[model samples]
Target chain A: MEYQRYNCGNCGACVAVCPQQILKLNENQVTKDPGCDECGNCTIVCPLGAFTWKVGHEV
Target chain B: MKYDVVVVGGRIGGSIASLYASKDDADVLMIEKRQEIGTPVQCAEGTTQSIFKILDMKPDKRYINAEIDGATIHAPDGRAIDLAEVSCENFLDGTGYKGYILDRKVFDKHLAIQAAKAGAEIMMKTTVKDLIRKDGRVCGVVAEHLGETMEIKADVVIAADGVESNMARQAGLTNPNKPGNIGSCAQYELFGLDIDPHQLNFYFGREIAPGGYLWMFPKGEDTVNVGLGVRSTKKTAYQYLNQFISRFKGTTPVELNIGGVPLSGPIDKTYTDGLLVVGDAAGHVDPVTGGGIHIAAFCGKTAGQVAAEAVKKENTSESVLKRYDEIWREKFGKNLEISLKYRNAADKLTDKDMNALAEFLEKNKIENLSKISAIKFLGKHPHLLMLIRDLL
Candidate 1:
């Protein structure tokens, strides 16, 4: 998954809603830990539409 | 780099603080993590006209979306009660009336611009990583700015960093929002809604929002901010928002926003040695209504003014910074206490209880309701008072 740095406000809204608890906000970007299940929760919870799945991968 | 004051966020509270601090001729710098000042907006953007008073200027046409005269509340049984006759006075100024739905992007940018014009330096895309402490006092911050890690020192640091504040924790202050204190929220900007453009609407029901309410605030002729907030529920706010959106036909949203609201009273302490926390970072939101813009504006200005004065006096100790806390608490503490009490009482109310309360208000010819009024009404009815006591 790729998150757009330009649109992210770093509000940590996505990190709060992530069920996997893999999302962490560092500096101004949200990063996912290796226990990676692409649940798409961060993509949906982001207020700024900043998160997007990598190309060729379905959310 | 060293400054008289360093504001950790460039949102409404931070911008206002910086503006006032700069007006006092203090060297101030505001840092924002986003590329744009107000990108990925988090507010419902509803505030009163008295914002003009705080800004000390007339209303700017660029940011005003709609002027609201009153509100209409919908009960769980679909009964609508108009509060047009109710006086919605400004909580601070106490003279002005009417609500406004703002274009937040423009409004926030305008505030930052005003601060800049007043001699405050604003740096976008700068994120504060941690506080630099010396002998238990926050002396500066370590931040990542423009791909470079740098240390910025300041006489005073203002943490207006929203609900997810790191400054408070770094300063050794406990997070004010406990498990049930924060309200999870989701909002959508929708068009093609058949809603009155001059009034706000609120829908309340446990089935809809367990411990919160749904709101429809008009932005323009055909656009509205449709949103919901709930606390401590098994379902996410997104699910509740989607379920609410399904009820309206022929409406599609153009934007989506999600965040958390501190529905608790102000934090136990907002001032630490050489540091002050304002806005949502300080939990300055009303517990019952989930409104914080006015509180933010009021407290932010006070914090800025006091900080500037303290710096001028060459003292940035917690004792000097404590004045900000005292002033704000004197102004808003009782009101917040009442709001929290009402929230506690309302949390225990069932759908039937809410319906009865609404009907009772209608029967009494009460058009406008406030926390004090609600308490008085409950006082008159022993059964309701008993219910509230049991819940508490």
Candidate 2:
């Protein structure tokens, strides 16, 4: 998995949309779990561009 | 007589701000224009489960009528999207949380109670006529209380005055909302109704309420809060709500809240020297959904904390209070900005496009719907999808 900088504002939109408990708010910002499988579940779910992929893909 | 902090408008943000300030060794006071807390409620009061964590209090069962797991979004063509239910706290703690349908009047009062318990003096039905300024900085508020115009002194003032935030405008922290950012919403608490109590229902139709959606929230076995929100561009919330209620074919209304949501983007600046703006007053509602409860609370708490910190430092400059805005922006600003872009995209969607989207969802699993796939689903209809793709 390639590394990316996601500014997750922690509104929990992604958490609200995530099927799995892979994302959460840490210190008022959103964070993904180490167990996250990168199913693009969060990237697809993010209303904002807060979630991103290792390789740039159409959101 | 003076105070360390004075919060104007005892709504969600104001109440929370007062509580935060008072709890931190500040002499805080909260003032409201209404005779009672949370009266003449304007909100649908549907809030995400994250509220508990935001307030750091367990909501008494009386305030929370039910815990909403999922929602049913029905399109104008009778197409529906069933958003899956996730654990409420998990949603906020991790990805996000479930929301609650509250009686805002009760909830707002509860918030004030928390503030009062924190040692903030609560004043009701008192209107702030203007800001008290000195050397080009705000020092307090000039308000009318019980037929007397009075000046209350404070080092800093927090404005949580809701949509028509004249206090902020008078202080020059924000301008009155432009027409585009306002949403007119109207709802009826209908008695004697039969509907799903668990699943919140949302309806979208071009003819029903253009530029907005209708909602049916079952309060209990026979009572429901049914309402519609239409963009001010299309019609007044009152006009759309009246038409929607007529189509209800349900029992008579027992109560009603006809109001507008300031879906406007957050003000460019939320603070001035000695003055801080919070809640709907600062136009902090979500751009797409026009929901402001959780965010209002979040910002209010932030404002309260920042004001308290400022008091500790003996500084109340716009620069100092600006920490509150920075915190709020760091937390929710970017997301709201992105949602506004989506709002632009959604507003341009035609009736045919909406109907097509509804039809597409009708044929698919409602549980799988989200922004990405929803866009993808809409993209399937070559013509409609192409239009959306190009626009997005």
Candidate 3:
């Protein structure tokens, strides 16, 4: 998954729903720690559309 | 350090739990990750008057932004249905009105102060990175503050952590929710608005908020909270919010609040040996409307009272702590279950269905609506009857 940091609110909505528990929010920033299956949960729950599919994962 | 109770998260749930435990003569400590208690407001800030009743305290004017008396529900086709003041606590169970819009920044800090006054020690900017488990029971937390790590010991550890909660998962009480079950919310506090300050407004349509609805809650005469919650939508909640706000010609946002609400109802269980989960961590939110502040406060107070009693008895085992689950569940569990079922049925409603329902409501007194009236209404709308037949 890719992130558009400008639109990111760093609210941790992604962190809450991430099954892999790979996303981290600290000091108003969200960072990923790999091992993502592109479940698209972040894309769906994000208020700011900061995350997008990393291509080819599209149905 | 050892304490009788350790509560994670410094929001409404944590503060209320700490307050009650301390008031009950149990030593308590609350840990918060943020530098301040409620710097960035996340909620729409509307809550029922019963919140004050639960706290056993009067409503303080310092944190109340508006005292609401009524509400107007706007349907997709622009039909407005007004609701008067009621005794009901929330929208899913009843209609609307008799509420207050709180300034959470002030309200949260005030709650922390109340906890402090009750002898509960609080630590801001302290993050609980992990729970300390002995054998199979949670008994403490491994926390980090200013890059320094320490293990704080407790007989009962209450997880009041918010939606991004890790403590509850570690205790094996809950799992990550599906995207469809989370309410992705975004809001803006606007400075210029022309609307009834004492009357709340809600706009509904898929084009507006998808699975949820748009709300305008007045904070002051000239300012209002405009927000919306959406679920499983192609467009982001922020995008939808921006689109809705564009209609207002001169309004400018003074603050932006965004967060996720757990709308799947309370978890299956909220207690284990030496562990109790409260607030959003336990999904103590209304599944239909995504409101949890008052519920969190109520559950927090219950957890605190229960934990303090368990501490006095020198037994914080699951057998004893499970009483916490039983108490709150008995009081609120059935309501949440019914709301979840209603939300599922409402999810299938189209704009036409909502408009039709609004039309029915405009002519009829929603407050006096009974099962017979609902059946009669459904008899006319077969499409809606098919969608909500089981719910009836």
In terms of DockQ, the best-performing candidate is 3
RMSD of each: 5.4, 15.7, 2.2
Candidate 1, overall lDDT? 0.81
lDDT of 3 by residue, B22-134 (tens): 99999999998889998778899999888888899899889999998888889999988875522234553343457899999999999999999999999988888899999
Clash pairs for candidate 1: none
Candidate 1 ranges beyond 4 A from true positions: A1-10, A13-28, A31-59, B85-97, B367-383, B387-392
Instruction: List model 2 lDDT by residue over B281-343, tens digit each.
Output: 787888877778889989999999999999999999988998998999998898788777777
lDDT of 1 by residue, B1-392 (tens): 99999998898999999999999988999998888887777888888777777778788769989987778888988888775444435432353437788899999999999999999999888888788899989888999977799999999999998876568866866442453676778889998898888888999998888789999999998789999888776566767888989988999999888777877777788999889999988888888888888789888898899889989999999999999999999988888888888888888888987887777666555355567877777876766788777546
Residue B305, candidate 3: Cα error in Å is 1.2
TM-score per model over all chains: 0.85, 0.80, 0.95
lDDT tens readout by residue for model 1, A1-59: 57787866566755544545565565556776777566665564454456667789853
Retained native contacts per candidate, as fractions? Answer: 0.10, 0.00, 0.72
Residue B313's lDDT in candidate 3:
98
Candidate 2 chain B weakest ten by summed lDDT:
B85-94
